[model samples]
Target chain A: MELQKKIEILSAAAKYDVSCSSSGSSRKNKPGGVGNGHLSGICHSWSEDGRCISLLKILLTNDCIYNCAYCVNRSTNDIPRTALTPDEVADLTINFYRRNYIEGLFLSSAVYKTPDYTMELILGVIKKLREEYRFNGYIHVKAIPGADMKLISAAGAYADRMSVNIELPSSQGLRLLAPQKNKESIIKPMGLIRSGIQAKREERKLFRGAGSFVPAGQSTQLIVGATPDHDLNILKLSEGLYHRFNLKRVYYSAYVPVTTGPNLPAIVKPPLLREHRLYQADWLLRFYGFKADELLNDAHSDFDTELDPKSDWALRNLHLFPVEINRVDYSLLLRIPGVGVRSAQKIVAARRIGPLSYDNLKKMGIVLKRARYFITCQGKYYGEKSMNEHIVRYGLISGKPEIQDSTPQWEQISIFPLLPQLPPPEVRLATLTGEL
Target chain B: MIYLYDGSFEGLLTAIFEAYYRKENPEKILRNKALQQTLFEEYIHIPTDEIKADKVYDSIRSKISHQALQHAYYTYLSDFEDAGTWIYRYLQLGWKMGHKVDYHLADDRVLTVHNTSRKVFGESHLLLGLVRFKKLSSDLFYAPIEPAHNIVSLIAPHFSSRLADQNWIIHDVKRNMAALYNKVEWVITELDANPNLTVDEEEQAYQGLWKQYFESIAIRSRVNPDLQKRHMPRRYWKYLTEKQML
Candidate 1:
């Protein structure tokens, strides 16, 4: 087949994977090499689906042996199959890199012939790209499930990052949809890559710049909404992956139905919002000092779609809030609804000069709309005295107060006295009291 | 008093030098083309002086840090109104507080300079990803970009380091300057090359493959043009090969 036709089929086959970041590795170009990798990755473009096009994300072939129901390239699906030679793949990467079209290559393949065979072909491309072409750019390749450990290790030395798609959150779901694949096949490679990265770090410590193994580290993707696994299950698995495998990122792909089967859910569209909420929760776990259990429990198995995970958590744990901005610890400041990592750091640095007021907090880049409810500037509070759960949730989700009929008569009567630029009486009332 | 200088980074530094020597903070610092002279207003044309500029640059480098100088330079790249005056305000603070002024985010002038510099840096970062090259008949790759800030220099180092094996030119059409990289080193030159250069025959095939892959990869059920435009704005769409079809 022609190269254009092949790329069309293969890239389409690979799009659902959605791990597009080409970051975390800092490999400088050799004297003879073509490209280099930056610590903070470069995104080449945003695809029509709003996902990043960081790398030349394509599969080696789309000829599958396993029929994963959620996947586009199922063995039973009637789709055209094509494969790219290792030479063709390497040439494409170099050409694309030279043209400044991509950061690097993200190569995956179906279980073509066998797991070991597919992995070898992928390894061949990376080996040729690194050794022959002298390509030093970031390369993220998939460690084929059930592939030989030695092949994965060889692939790891050449590629900057590796991944093994969990596909489904639960093992039972994997068995129901993809009988040829099992949990052990997926996990064993992750463990191997983890150990290899750990071992490489140790080696580098003793001998500086001893060739880094998977320096960008490994990441995995889970197909959400495919199986009946709860959000808690996914978060728990992600938390485990982060701690156990030392994964850089755990991608949640909203399950887009490509093949219909008995086991798959009859859905019209992918659960994108659900996937978005999961990412927000994942950020909390990674950066905001949040535990998985703290965000979700048996009663609330999923995140609130209306409000963000951080805001939801804040509304539930209101006692922790109304923390004094001037006196509160940096760790506690992060718990406020609108205070992100950057803003939290800014608040810490700015407060060093003097005690901060509500005006100062706004200038420091805090999102006052949401944060006002959670924090007090010096001795003054600008939030409502009656912090009812429903009212707070309603206020936060709506993000604005109703000036029409439903607003309280007492609040309405007071609004006539205030100027247009000034906030409502509720805001002024908190300012007047100097505490809520 | 208003001072007008040639629109070069060194000229801006020279203006700063003159402002300091005279002990006068000009109400406005305008580029030569941007000057608006009135009957009563004092307008002085500041010539570009490398020695004087370097002296001011050295003090900034010594008293503050190179990072602070970079912030001022990057802010100058932005097309924000009164960005020159803002840089002067920021430098006044920087000279007093030294390197610690960067951490003083509460100060409005410090924050404005920081934010504008951040925006310029952000655009340069985006251009690193958004730049698209088409192979010419001579095997030299050519890319045309129109960025909000004069960020061609900021993003040029990235492409030069990555595409060291290939000869390429990134033309900032808005500024009428190009960064030409010739396999070993790069130089910023006046853009004399034609905008409508022909693509190589082989390049057409790869462009076709890229466009095809671009379309095929988007999930049909989850198409959101607004989000795509948000990340890759409409301003940049004309140069993007994949975006051309839509």
Candidate 2:
């Protein structure tokens, strides 16, 4: 096959994995190296899906031995099966990196022939890029499940970040959708990568010249809305992954239906809103110090489609509202509905100078519409309505229209014209019928 | 009183130094080319002096903080019309309040200078990734950009370290200048709008492959053009190889 044809097929197949972050690594360029990692990561472009195109995200090949029902590259699918040579992969990475087209390579592959064989091919490509090409840019490789410990560890020496797709939220979902794969095969590699990173940290502390082992750490992806898994379950699993494996991130891909099977849910569109809510909750967990149970529980297995996760949490715990902004702790400020990390920091810094009024809060970049419902400035309440749950919920939901007005006209007309503007009865009916 | 100086950063600093040295409060500080004369208004043209500029620079670094100096420098690089006045007012406040001026986010002068500096820093950071280099026939990679701010010099050191083994030139087409890197060091110099250079034979082929990969990677089910345009704005699409077809 031609090189362009190979890149098209491989990249299209690889898009389903959905981990495009080029961050968390600051690998410096050697004396004669060609690239260096930016600590905050740089995005080269944005794809049509509005996703950041950071790295050269392409599979080494799409030929798989395992037949997963949710995957586009299942063994049963009669798609074009092709693989790039190690030289081709390295050459593509260097040429693209030189042109400032990409940050580096994100090499993933299907289980072609065997797990070890696929991993070896990926390792060869990384070695060629690092050694021969002297490309010191960010690289994110996949640690093939069931691959040998030595092979996975060796691959980590060159890869800045590595990920093993959990494939499903639960082992039950894995068993139902992907019969060939087990949860043990996925968790085993994560455990190995975690220990390897720990060992490297110890070695680095003792000897400064010790080789780096996955300096950006490991992350995993879970396919959302594919199986009958609740958002609570997914959040809990992500919380566990973060705490146990010490993982950097857990990506939740709103399962796009590429193949149909009896086990898969037939959906008209990808669950993008749900995926977005999960990310919001994930951010709360990572930065805002919110637990999974605080966001979701058995009473609420899914997020409210109208309100964000933070707003929902705030509404549920109304006793915590009207906290005095001047005297509030930094942690409590973060729990406010509209006070983000930056705004909270600004409030903390600006308050040190003197007491702040609502106008000062606005100047500090706080979203006052939602924040006023939960905060008090100088012992004065700013919420338009009384501190009642029903009144606050109504005010929050009614505030959606003004936000929609800022969106482009076409998007408002196409997606959300009637949803936010409709009366309570029709909106409730839509919610009950799953139209929202 | 209105103080006029050349548009160089040193000239801006020298004007500020003259304001302090002469004990005259200027109504507006502007570049000589940007000055608009009004009847009965006093105008003083300050010559660029490196000694006076360095004295003010040392005082800012000593009295306020190094971060404050960086904010002053970045704010000057923004090339905004009122940037000179804002920096002057900001430094005036910094001299009084010490480093605590930055924490006064509610103050208009401090906030304006801080926000302008942040804007310049953000644009330079974005250009680090958005720059696209095409290999020329002379084996020197060349890129052209029309950035919203004067950020070519700010982003050059990053490329000098990143593509350290290769020679490259990043041409700022809007400002008619370029950062020429010769593997070891980089310097910003004036370059014409049209260089009349020829691309290497393999440049077109690599661009084609990149365009193909870009088109293939987007999921068809979640095609949000608004989001794409939000991240990579329409103004930057002209130079992006993948967006060339669009």
Candidate 3:
């Protein structure tokens, strides 16, 4: 087959995995090497779905031994299968890196022939890219499930980051759809990688210039909406993975149905909005000191699609509102709806100069429209006098306050047309129903 | 009065030096080509003086933090209308407040300089990702960029460090200058002569493969061109290998 045809098939098969970032490593180029890696990943382009295309994400082959229901490249799909030789993979990566087409390579593969065989092919490509081509760019390779730990470790010496897809959130879901794979096959490699990385770090501290093992660390993808997994289940599992494996990132791929199946949920569209909400909640868990139970619990299994997780959290806990902009601690400042990590830090720095006002907060990148209801400037509230949950929710989602506006006659007539705007019932219903 | 200088970083510094030495708050500072004749305001020609420019540069380096100096340099690269006046105001504050001037975000002049510098940095950062190099038959990697900001100098350090082993040229076609890097060092040179540049015969095949990979990677179920445009703006699509028509 032609190289173009192979790339088309392999990349299409690999796209569903959805771990596109080529970041977390700052590997500098050697004196004779051709490329370097930056700490902040550089996205080469944006795919049509608005996803960042940072790496040359492709598979060694699309031919697989197991049939995972949600995957497009399952054995029973009868798709045109192809594989790239180790030389072709290395050639493409070096040429593309020189042309500045991509930051690095994100190489993955199916269980072609056998797990070890597939891993060896991947290892060959990376080894050639590093050793032969002298390419020092970021490389993120997948550690195939059930593959030999020795081969995985060999691959890790060359790759900056590695991943083993936790295909389903739960083993029960994995059993029904992907019978050949089990949770142990996936998590065991992750555990090995964590320990390998730990050992490497210790060795590096003692012996200068020791080779790094998976220098960017490891990440994993969990397919969302394939089974009836709750957001709480996903978040808790992610929190556990972050703590246990010291994982860099937990990627969530919204399940896009590819084939008809009795076991899988027949989702017409990928739950992108739900996926987006999960990412927002996941950010809170990772960055903002928020626990999984605080964001969602057994009672609330899913996120409120109508509002962002932070805003929803604030609305649910209304007693926490009216945090004084001057006196609010950094953690509470972060919890405020409009303030981001940067802005919260800015507020902390700027308030040290003097007590900040509403204008100053807005200037410092705080979203006053959302934060006004939750915070005050010098013990004075700019939001409504009678702040109720329903009113706050309405203001948060609809961008219109429930209270009637009394515009003075002098300010009524402007160049623009003045019309009485009312909230459409469907928007109101969508907000109330907590669905977008 | 309007002060006009050669369109160079040193020239802008010289103009700032003159502004300080003469103690005349000029109504506008512009490049020679950008100067407009007004019936009311007078025009003064400022010659580029490296000695005077370096004096200002040294004072700035000593007085303000390196971070603030970078902000001023990026703001100069922004080439926004009234950017010169904004920088002048920003430096006036910087001279007084020293390093603490960056935290004075509430000051409108400081804010404008900060925001415009951010725009310049943002574009330079985006070009770091969006640049697509096509291999020339001479074995020199060539990339053409037309960024909104004068970011060729800003992005040169990044490419030089990354592609240190290969000779490469980043041509800012809009600004009519090219950063020519020869492995060890680089210099920005005027690049009007195209010289009938041609890609390697196999370059087309690899570009075709890249375009195909780009198309196939996008999920059909979630096609949102608007979001893609937000990240990789449509203005930059002309030079992108993946965005070109087959």
Q: Which candidate is the best by TM-score?
A: 2
Candidate 2: where is the Cα deviation over 4 Å? Answer: A400-436
**What TM-scores do the predictions have?**
0.93, 0.94, 0.93
User: What is the per-residue lDDT of model 3 for residues B54-73, given as tens digits with 9 covering 90 to 100?
Assistant: 98888888998888778888
Q: DockQ numbers for every candidate?
A: 0.60, 0.89, 0.67
In terms of lDDT, the best-performing candidate is 2
Binned by DockQ into CAPRI classes (incorrect, acceptable, medium, high), candidate 2 is high
> Each candidate's chain A: what TM-score?
0.91, 0.91, 0.91
For model 3, the superposed segments whose C-alpha errors exceed 4 Å read A403-436, B193-195
lDDT tens per residue, model 1, A391-420:
677678777653336655663356655756
On residues B49-128, what C-alpha lDDT tens digit does candidate 1 reach at each position? 99999998999999999989999999999977688888888998999999888878878998899899999999999999
Using DockQ, rank the candidates from best to worst: 2, 3, 1
Task: Estimate, for each residue in A157-194, the C-alpha lDDT of model 2 and write its tens digit.
Answer: 99999999997999899999888999999999999999
Shift of residue B124 alpha carbon in model 2, Å: 0.8
DockQ for model 2 equals 0.89
Cα error, residue A123 of model 2, in Å, equals 1.0
lDDT of 1 at B10: 89
